[model samples]
Target: MITKKQIDNNTLSDEEIVKRIVNGESYLYEHLMRKFNLRLFRISMSIINDEMEADDVMQTAYINAYMQLSNFQHKSSFSTWLTRILINESLLHKKRKLKQTQLLAAQTDNEYSNDNPLRRLMNKELKVILEKAVSTLPEKYRLVFVMREIEEMSVNETMEILNLGESNVKVRLNRAKEMLRSELSIYYKTNEVFEFNLIRCDRVVNFVMNKINKES
Candidate 1:
């Protein structure tokens, strides 16, 4: 398990952390979890369309990745590799969720608390506002937008993650920006929509760490 001091000490590059973790320093995996939580959450939300379900997908992805960390070949950045795992898990979860939705009447409830303040003006409510707008986008463009604009990953990484060519990634990103340009212009203050806050961050880290610890 990661100690308190180790959690705040993230001076290592992700590749170094992975190498060490694979060499038996498994507690270091916590650093990777905290570092990529927000990115995974945002991308998962773009695909999954539900925060809670996105969190669930993220947990499964982390656990699966940890169990298979030895297979990472360093062909891509660790973030890209982990993100690919998250994307696959999210897509599979979405398919299963879609079937369940068809059989069961979907009901939505408003229960997200807005206690965090972004720049003293953009609260969680505003974040939700932008999320709803972004969620309205088609999945292909939504994924492109979240990875390119929101998460700020490089085009090459996004292309590899989405299994698209550079041209296709560029085109989809441009189309996504044009579609959301007018709608998101006013919501500029709240650029970060699907933020993975610390509370939820700890919950996910603890869940994954505990699961891996038990299995180890």
Candidate 2:
């Protein structure tokens, strides 16, 4: 009932794609996953602050979204609904990771500083530092920052996804920028940060497709 041209050319709206997928064109789901992979990864990274964990969260979120696709009511755009699901998954995963970290701390003789994950970058290129700067933002501001600035979404879209009022979204975004040191502003490029490269996209798409197919 589907053809390669439809997938390759992306001729359908997201809502149209979702409607078909729910009606038995399940393979069409790959299109949706590949489309939002980058956006979802960055949003999840804003909260998880760890690349590996962010990928893991994104994977789980995609699976959860697919399984619950029938319940989607078209109240919001597909991206907004998917984003809400990702945010919830990210928050739950962060809470669980924190609990695990705290338990490990209690079991050991060492003190805990509650620091963000630290790594020794071989070189502090603008791209690398920009990523570090965003990753280090407090969770509240970080989510708003990614949705508004990096994703270049409108105020209403960001507000809907984040459940924030228009003024609150603006305030949080401004605050997120302020938290980044002045020096970092000299070299700005959001796309360079949290990139989900081609190979990564293929792996995720293949993985999600395989899981969804098994359900059919």
Candidate 3:
């Protein structure tokens, strides 16, 4: 039973934690999953454009990464490697979803309801608007924007994760900002976008923990 105090000591890096898990202290993997759940969720959501599907994509990615943990050579940072797996999973899911939608449309021609942000306005109206604006961005730009601007990852780190050169990363980021600037002038001060609420965070953590425990 890994306690919060053990994880809170914060002395061990991600690499060291992986080593511990590989050495059979499997419970510690929950700490790593919790650490990156929100970032991965945001990443999945940015690509998939559907929250529930994004959640499922993240869960599958985590399970796949854990199963392949031994193959995680020190070629890149653990987060980068995990992110790559997540991106692959999300893209694959997206491809499958597109195919399904095409086939379903051919059969039934059912229409889907547009998610109108105006109807969801509340106290945090600006935040909701900002999230919608970010989500509406073209996929190429949205992922870069979220990784660089929202997650605050460094240029080098973003480049490593996305397999893009610094210039490409900067260019995409600039374009994303330009698009958002036009839409968010009055509401650009707040940085929160696609916030992973605490309840969802705990849910993801518990789901992953339970799955890992059962497998072990």
Candidate 4:
């Protein structure tokens, strides 16, 4: 895996990298791929809930991106532009796999997903319980929540990725938060308290950001 130090040492800025890619210095594009793969995977996974499919979505998005590279207008951050493509790819996969009954089944089963060992020590046994609750959210709400809350993307960036307007994003985010809070309330017995440790998740955030940056 490429390290941040390696990324920082790379010679080209994003625009420069794009120019190089467009000029047929195709190998430089691999550097971008390495940068953004993780972040894109996370987004794709949040939508599809299938690891292999998420990987496929990321790969397909890149292929589509490379073919359309000449059309990139620099209107949005390169990261946002690439992410939007992946988001669409993931959603398309969801649509193809869509079944009303299966969606309901996944929602009902969301409460029993895996627990990260570290999370147990950080919070109560109920940490994964809350996560499961979030998992049960409708796909639309779930995607927005994960992008904004877990990925910590800015509203504008999210709007670009989700192809939503500012007001729509806000509305969905608010509803998602409300649903999460309500579910957590029940999971915690309405008495057990838990504090989120931002510091612990910093590495995850950095990892995702670097993946996107490199994959770009």
Q: Name the top lDDT candidate.
A: 3
Give a tens-digit lDDT track for model 2, residues 1-216: 346855753667999999999999898988888889999999998999999999999999999999999999999999999999999999999999999999997765233223312222323354688888899899999999998788889999988988889999889988889988664765556776777889779989999999999998
Candidate 2 error regions (>4 Å): 1-3, 6-9, 110-216
- What lDDT tens digits, residue by residue, belong to model 1 across residues 1-216? 577666544677788888888998888887789889999999999998999999999999999999989999999998999999999999999999888876564332212223424433546566787888889789999999999889999998998888999999989888887877767766665655677899889999999999999999
Which regions in candidate 4 have their CA more than 4 angstroms from the true location?
A: 1-9, 99-216
- For the record, the alpha-carbon RMSD of candidate 2 to the native fold, in angstroms, is 20.2
Model 4 CA lDDT for position 54: 87
Q: List runs of model 3 lying over 4 Å from the truth.
A: 4-9, 109-216
- Candidate 1 weakest lDDT stretch, 10 residues: 107-116
TM-score, one value per model: 0.45, 0.49, 0.49, 0.43
Model 3 residue 191 CA deviation (Å) reads 49
Candidate 4, residues 25-100, lDDT tens digits: the string is: 6766788898898899888999999998788888999999999888899888788989999999889888877876
Query: Where is model 2 poorest over a 10-residue stretch in terms of lDDT?
Result: 113-122
What's model 2's lDDT at 102?
92
Candidate RMSDs in Å, in order, are 20.9, 20.2, 20.1, 19.7
Winner on lDDT (1 vs 4)? 1
* Candidate 3: Cα lDDT at 2: 69
Give the per-residue lDDT digits (tens) of candidate 3, residues 150-179: 899999999998999999999999999999
